[model samples]
Target: MLSAQHINKSFSGVQVLHDVHFSLLAGEVHALLGENGAGKSTLLKTLFGMYRPDSGTLSVAGTPVVLGSPKDAQAQGIAMIHQELALIPELSVAQNVLLGNEGRELLNYGRMQARVRPFLEQVGLNVHPATPVKRLTIAQQQMVEIARAVARQARIIIMDEPTSSLTTHEIGQLYRVVRDLTARGVGIIYVSHHFDEIEELADRVTVLRDGRYIGTVRQRDVTQDQLVTMMVGRELVAQTAPPERTPGAVRLDVRGLSSNVFREVSLQVRAGEVVTLAGLIGAGRTEVLRAIYGADPSTGGEVRLEGVLMSRRTPADMMGRGVGFIAEDRRHQGIVPDARVSVNMMLTSWAKGKVGVGERDMLRAVEPQIQQLGIRPANPHQIIRRLSGGNQQKVILGRWLSAGCDLLLIDEPTRGIDVASKADIYALIDDLARSGVAVLMVSSELPEVLRLSDRILVMREGRLAGELARADASEERILALATGVHTHAKDPAVA
Candidate 1:
């Protein structure tokens, strides 16, 4: 029902999309596959009226159209669910569902709930209409987002990484919802990092690379490896490496860690060792790391660094104790997007008295590190927001490494980043380990855990399910632990 012809878009003199042509038909789920910065999001935004394409023709159902604003797009039956969900935490499901264009004179609570009830049921959500959204899990919150779209009666829905943070079971539920939407003649634009999902949910796939269209193919005609080759224009390097260990004394220790979202969990990491925390989403993996780093409050836990006991404290206190934290949400929690590269690079150091007294000295301190980290467009004054997502993450990591923390607690080191940059990030982390730093990484990608970690720890339902040596952990083993599978047969190709 939606179509675009010869679309073109740019940002700050850089061409992000060029001669991009795309279309969607009723009841077809079209998968858009690409690396980060491939203009996938830009194309979606242009169609959704967030940006006016410099030159292109858009049509809906054979008639040319202009979507000058979000309202205009919505009026045209187009809806987009952003990668970052837009639900207001304090609002109830009913309130959020009826947010835009709430009915007449008085806002009718009973009518609002009644209006939302069927949509919730249609999406298979068991949430109460009156329940606050903040209390719901990520999967439930995502359902609320989908329900909102359904309530709007959108004909074309764009879902960006919809299953990135969802569990296997939750993904199945979402797939059913998508299938149901398609059955009712709705079209879907699916974007994701996982290619397997594309095979499962998509009718056709289009690949984009470096802001240009590579090609499109029928799902049944191509394999996953072929899709990757088209999207990247290269064979994916075999990413298997036997885990190495030269571990030393304990670097970080936690005893009886308790938080509002997590229970009394304890863990440890040693110097020169990479410990990975693996679990299904909402298994309290991120919470455990955050609590130890003092980003979130821990009700009852004694955190120790190098045998020194740390009391209940804040992030600053944790940093002062030789601990570093790389939060999962880099956009919101990690870096100042609008600031210059040098400023972001010096953020952690300036806080720790590493920046020099004079302006010249401080500039000197920032320049070398930025260059060493290979931050692209290496101009120190370049705004970080202008850089690619992977480059932004590198600057953030450069800031942390400059601060010289002995212990690093990182969350989702590769989420939403490109594959080439993922390799660089792995190298950086490996170098940190060679320097005798203890690294505790939490990732959802099974291959990453197998490739980079010296040891792996699995969590289930807010508890430590089990721990395995790198030699012993396989994708199957980690999956079994994460998904509650029991198997006696061991896979030799663990790495």
Candidate 2:
């Protein structure tokens, strides 16, 4: 349906895409594989007219096309759904679906709802047409986006990380929708970090590395190992399970923790111990972390640190008490985007009364951590916004490190980071624990839960369903606990 040849794009003297080539067919799902900064997003934006390529030729149905804006791409029957969805939260589902396509003259609510009904049904989005988009779940909202794309009669749809936040069941629903669209001859450009998703959904796959086109292969012909090698340009090492450690003095103790979302929850982390909270997206793991960090105060609970009951438990209070937190929403909650890396890195120190300290001293101190954490370009003055997703997360870790936190509450430290960055973060977590810092983490990735955690606590609905030692944990056991179920079959760990 669409193709680009010899594409080259750059920003601020930095070349982001170099001699890149990509193509999509009328009814094919093409998977784009890459690390965070491997030019995947740039390529998608180039196709969608968000960025005019420095040098490239694009064709639609064998006719050359120059797209100056997204409207031009839309005119050619091309549409893109960004990873971070752009739905208007306050608008109703039907309204969002027919936003621009609403009739020219008359404000016809009934007609619009009727028009959107078939598209919604096609995508299996069974929510009320009049329900506000904000009221829908992420997966439901995603289906609504698909419904809107189908309403627009887009021949090719670009989906970026569509299943990142979705549950397994939600992913199945999306696969069904994709099947329906493909049946109607719609081409899809699928971008994701998930190997399994690509293996299942993509017919052909293209790999990009360091802004250059690596190669393209049919899914059946190329193994996952080959894909990884091409995207990263190396034989990537696998992360092994963390080493065992003896639990030291209790650091964070939550007894009878009760919040609006969860109730009667109790957990503990010891000095030099790493305890991971594992569950589904809405299983209340993040909420539990928030309550412990005092970002969201629990309704009824007592949190003790080192056998001392706390009076005040706000974020400021927690920071003052040698506790640091990395929130779930990193962009909005964790880091200051506009600030320089040196300034952002020292935020925790400033919070802990580093007002009179010299800027040179601060920069000098963080330079080693920056080197240690592998923040790219080795420049401590780069704007946080300019860094890739992985580097941004490293800055968040740097902030906590500067604060000298005795106890850290981290949520999804590797949510959107790439594979290599994930390894760095995992190593840092182990280093922190070995340095006698208590770590309480919440992660949705099951492999992460099983790999880095010395102990795993599985939450379901709003309570702790089960706990497993590192020696006893398995993916099936963790998932069973997360879903509030148990089977008698022997897993290797249990066996």
Q: Against the true structure, what is each candidate's TM-score?
A: 0.90, 0.94
lDDT of 2 by residue, 122-202 (tens): 999888888999999999999888988988899999998898779999999999888888888999999888889898899
User: How much is 93 displaced in model 1, in angstroms?
Assistant: 1.3
Model 2 — which ten-residue stretch has the worst lDDT? Answer: 486-495
> Which stretches of model 2 miss by more than 4 angstroms?
355-366, 377-381, 490-495
- Candidate 1 worst ten-residue window by lDDT: 486-495
Candidate 1 lDDT over residue span 1-495, tens digit each:
988888888766667788987889899999998876677888888889988998989999999999898888888888888778989999898888767856751267788888789999999999889999999988999999889888889999999888767878899999999999999999999998777788889998888887788888898999888887887788887666645769899999888888888787888899998999998887899999988887888888788888888886788988887788998988799889888878888888887897764668767877888778776656777777766667778888888887889999899998877666677788888889878999999999988888899989899888887888887888888877776767677543222
Task: Give residue 474's error in model 1 in angstroms.
Answer: 2.5
- The numbered model that scores best in TM-score is 2
Q: How accurate is candidate 2 locally (lDDT)?
A: 0.87
